[model samples]
Structures are given as structure tokens and as C-alpha cells.
Target: MLVLNGPDGKFVVDTFVAPAWPRLKEALDGLGNAPVKCVIDTHWHFDHTDNNTRLHAAGATVLAHENTKKRMSEPHDLPVLYRGTDGALAGLHFDPSPVEALPQQTFFDTCKLQANGESLVLQHVAPAHTDTDIHVHFENANVIQMGDLFFNWMYPYIDPSTGGKITGMIAAANKILSLAGNDTKIVAGHGPLGNKADLMEFRDMLVTSCDRVERLKSAGKSAQEVVAEKPFADLDPIWGNGIINSEQWVQVVYLTL
Candidate 1:
């Protein structure tokens, strides 16, 4: 999450996972009594928006892309593929988020806010990570919070069920790179903070991996065959160590393609 403090007040980006709201509140309390004027959700994912209710209840006006608000307002199940007790791939489900946690303020392509003496720009990057994904740029601070559109050093999870795609992910990364410079600090959705170079590397990785997977698929290879071929073997050591493992990453990309 990105928090900016200036003359106006305090502004927070992304509420983090649901279970961590209390800890977030405690940390916020320690920051004195600066009122939270706004809370922005980069997307509708539970991990990014679960604390909306608490923050909103505390008087923060929650804002997000229109798609995010719509997604959060309904019941949508997330698909989870994992190895079962028999060591075979199995599927699991993630229930929809609570309606109270939905964002009240929604925008289409872009939204701008002036707070804490900073200019905050939220720009939508569609069909990447999720349909509701957005990039939050604190212009005065030279920091950009790239919601789930960037995964830093890890293989990103693409939710096709929500309009996420490998190609769109690459496009989003490129868009961020275009907006950033050498000195800009980038706050990724997960993993460590990064800069333009890191984003470039991530974009390259996505392109190469997608190309490899596409080639295999074009040759009439099955998803299991593509996985066996280890299309992203070279990248697994560095980017595959995050929440999305190598095998799971392969499956998602292959299925999406």
C-alpha cells in the first residue's frame, strides 16, 4: 500500500488483505491523528481491497475503477489449482468479497485527486492482472503504485476469469515503463519496490515466456506438454519463487493462451 502525507491530509492506496486490517489500523493510529481523506483500490482483488469497509467506516472515501466496484459488488468465485493429497492437480474456490467493502467512488479511464499537497493520478490499465487494474501515480513524490499490473521479481498471477491476459500484462508493464524514469520509485502490487529497469526486465520476461508458450501451442502441444518443456525454466529461479510457483504459473499462462 502507498501512503502519502502532506498539507491536506493522509492518502492511502490499496487496503491490503482482510485479516491485516487491525494491524493496518494500529499502524495508522501511530501516525498521529491525521485524517485519512481517501483510499484507492488498484483493483477488486480481495488482497487489495479487503480493508475497504474499515477504512470507509473510518471516514475515508474509497475510490476505484468502475469495473472494480462492479466486481466487488457481486459474488464471483476465483479458481485455484493445486496439487491434492494424491499429488494430482485439483481446483479450489475463493468466494466473493463483502459488499460493505466495495468502493463507493468509481471512475472510468482516469481519476485525479489533489490531497496532501500532492497530485495523485489513477489511470486504468485494462485486462491486465484484472480488468479493474490501475496505476496510482503520486506526481509530486515521483512514486507510482502499479497495483497488480506489476509483480516485481515474481511470475504474476493472471486471472482470465476477470479479463486478465498475458498480452495485456505486457502492455501494462510497457505503459508503466513509458511513464517512469530512472529516479522514479515504483511500488509493485507484490514483492519488493522497483524502478524502470526492474519493470523493463519484467516486461522482457513476459514477452519471452509468452512467445515460447505460443510456439509450443502452435506446434499442437498440450498444456501438460508445454509445462514439461519448461518454457520458463530460465526465469523460474528468480521470478518463480513468489506466491505463484513455476508449475502453477505455466498452467495459468497456458490455459489463458
Candidate 2:
């Protein structure tokens, strides 16, 4: 999550889960004691949007991409996300968010804003991680917040249920690379902070995985067959140490293809 002290009040980029609000509130209060004027949702994922109600109740208007509020208004079951305690491919069931937590203002394409004495540019990408993905670019500061598009050193989970595409993921990275310079700071949705070189490396990893998975898929190999072959064994030690293992990563890539 990012905080920008605006001319009027504070501008928060995203939020943590509801349980983290007290610590979040303390952090906000510690930063100049400014009221939150607005909160931005990078995407509709619960991890990024669970605390909207608290901040909204505090009188902050929420801003997000057009699809964010829509997605939040519906229920979702993502079996690819996890398995139940039974150890089968069952997903967590999500209920619709309360009306108070919904975004009040949304933009279709690109929106520009002036906050913290800096110009912020928000742009939508084509369904990379999820259909609601948007990146916030702080132009003057040369910093970019890639909502879930860049996963840093780990293999990213592509959400096929919401139109996530490996090709779109590649395109989104190129978009950021085009807008970024060698000195630019790239804040990823997960993992440590990154830069242009780090982003480039991550993009290359995506390309290699996509290409390998596509080849197997084209050769009439099932996702499980590809997983059994362990095509990504070499890349796993470096990139598969995250929440997703190599086998699961192969299935995810294949599904996107």
C-alpha cells in the first residue's frame, strides 16, 4: 500500500485486509494527521480492497477502474486460488462487498490527478492479472505502482476466470517498461520493491514460461502431462519458491493459454 500526502488530505493507493485496519489507521494518523481524502483500488481483489468500508466511513471517497465496483458487487469462487481443508480443488467463496465499501468514482480509460504536489496518471491494462487491473504512475516522482501485473521474482498466478491472459501480462509489462527509465522505481503488487532491470527480468521469465507452456499445449499435451514433465524445473528454484509451486504454476500457465 502507498500513501501520498495531498494538498487537501491523504491519498492512499490501496489497503490491507480488515484485520489490519488498526495498524493501518495508526500509520495514517502518524503521517501528518491528515484525513484520508481518497483511496484508490488497484484491483478488486480482497487483499487489496478489504478495508474500503473503514476508510470510506472515515469520509474518504474511493476511486478505481470502472470494473472494480462491478466486481466487488458480485460473488466469486476461484478454485485455482486454493484447495479446501479436504485437500481437493475447492476455492474460497466470496460474498459481495457492502455498499459502503464500493468505489464511488471510477474512470474508463485514463485519469489524471494532482496530489502531494505530484501528477498521478492512472491507466487500465487489458486483463493481465484480472480484468480490473490498473497501474498508478507518479510522473514527477518517477515511480510506478503495478497493481498485480508484475510479480517480481516469483511466478504470477494468472486469473483465467476474469480474463487474465499471458499475452496481456506481457503487454502490460512492456507498457510499464516504455513509460519507465533506468532510474524509475517500480513497486510490484507482491514481493520486494523493484526497478527497470528487475521488471525486465520478470517479464523475460513470463515470456519463457508462456512459450514453454504454449509449446506443450500445442503438442497435444494435457496440463497435468506438462506438469509431470517438469519443464520448469530449472526456473523453479529462483521463481517457484513463492506461494505457487512449479507444478501448480505449469497448470496455471497452461490454463491461460
Candidate 3:
């Protein structure tokens, strides 16, 4: 977890999770006895928000998109899949947390937060990542914490079942571009950090992928065909190394579009 101290002396803690909680607390301790005032979660993914209980208990208010609140408060069935690794012995199971607490405040379009004299802009940019993904902009500091919208190196995961769309993905990227300049620091949900140029590249990739998927759809191509068709071959070398791959991406694009 990297702690960046804002101009107002407030610390913007990043990547607060299970494995990193001890380290995060240590970092906070290093900042003296100043109690954490607020904690702005980029999104409601368990990895990013499971520690919300602890933070809230420590006097920090948790914030997230309206959709994130809804999703987190709903019942979820665990996912179990068998890996064809030579036998039935290889498999994976995922058990998500049951509906619990939710964000007290949620906005459909945009919401701004002022803390410790620092201004933070939270904007909903969804149908691009999840049903309610948002971007946190530290306006004065010229830094944005883009939840899952901008994955620096890995292929972005588009949750199709939750209204995620390829077109919306591009629009979300453009929205971020409008809010930031060339030198603005971009903290991605995963992977390395980036800037405006990186954002443009991500936007362009989404646009190109959208165009490809649309074309394929118009050609009466099936989902299988779309997956088999590697329309994003150009981006494979740069952003295709992850659990999200060209085939899965194409399937999502085709399905969503």
C-alpha cells in the first residue's frame, strides 16, 4: 500500500486490503497519532472494500457508487468451476460475502467531497466496468483514482451481466480525459500507475475493440465467432496478459453490444 500525503496533510491510503491491512496500519501509525477522517473506496470489490468495517470502526466514512452499494447489499452465490487439469481434482471455488452495509451516500451522475480542505470529485462511469463504477478525482491535487475502468497493463474485465458495455467503456475513458490533463497522476484499480497518454491509449483500445465487435455483430457473427476472432490482436502484446484474455473480451463486447 502506497500512502500519498495530500497538500492538506491528509493521507490518501491506496490498496487497503486483507493481506495489506497490517502494512497499511503500520504506514498510518508512521503518520503520527492523527486519526483517519475518511476512506473513499474506489469501488465495492471485496479485495478493496472488505476492510471498510475496520476503517469505519476507526472513524472513517466509506463512500462508493450507488450501484456498488446495491450490489454489496444483495445475496450472492459462490462460484465453483472445475479446471480441466487432467482430472476432477483441479478446481476453484469462490465464496463472496453476503449483503451487509452499504454506502450511506450514492449519486447517479456526480458527487463531490471535501475533506480536510481537499476537494474530491466522485463521478459515476458505469456500463463500462460494472453497473456502478466510479472515478475519484482529487481535483486540487490533479490525481484520479480510477476504480476498474483503467487497468494499466492487464486486460480490463467488463462485467456484462451488470450492464457493462464496450461503448460505455470508451465513453467512460473520454470522461476521464475531459477531467484530467497531461500531467495528472492516474491510480488504476490494478497494475502500474499512469497518466493522460496511458488513458488515451486505454480509450483508443476500447474504441477499437468496440468497433471490431460491432462489425462482427453486424456480420451476423455468433458469440463463438467473436471469441474466436482476435480483433484486438494489436493490443495483445501490451495489455492482454491476465485472467481476462482476447477471447473473453471479445465475447463480452459482442454480448454487451
Give the number of the best model, judged by TM-score: 2
Q: What value does the lDDT take at residue 249 in candidate 2? A: 79
- CA lDDT of 52 in candidate 1? 86
Could you give me the TM-score of model 1 versus the true structure? 0.94
TM-score of 2: 0.95
Give the 10-residue window scoring lowest on summed lDDT in candidate 1.
83-92
TM-score list, all predictions: 0.94, 0.95, 0.84
Those runs of model 2 whose alpha carbons end farther than 4 Å from true positions after fitting are 81-90
Regions more than 4 Å wrong, model 3: 1-16, 77-101
Regarding TM-score, does 2 or 3 come out ahead?
A: 2
Residue 100 CA error for candidate 1 (Å)?
A: 2.3
Q: What is the lDDT for 202 in model 2?
A: 91
Model 2, 117-189: lDDT tens digits are 8899999999888899999999999999997898989988787777888888999999999999999999988
**RMSD for each of the candidates:** 2.0, 2.0, 3.8
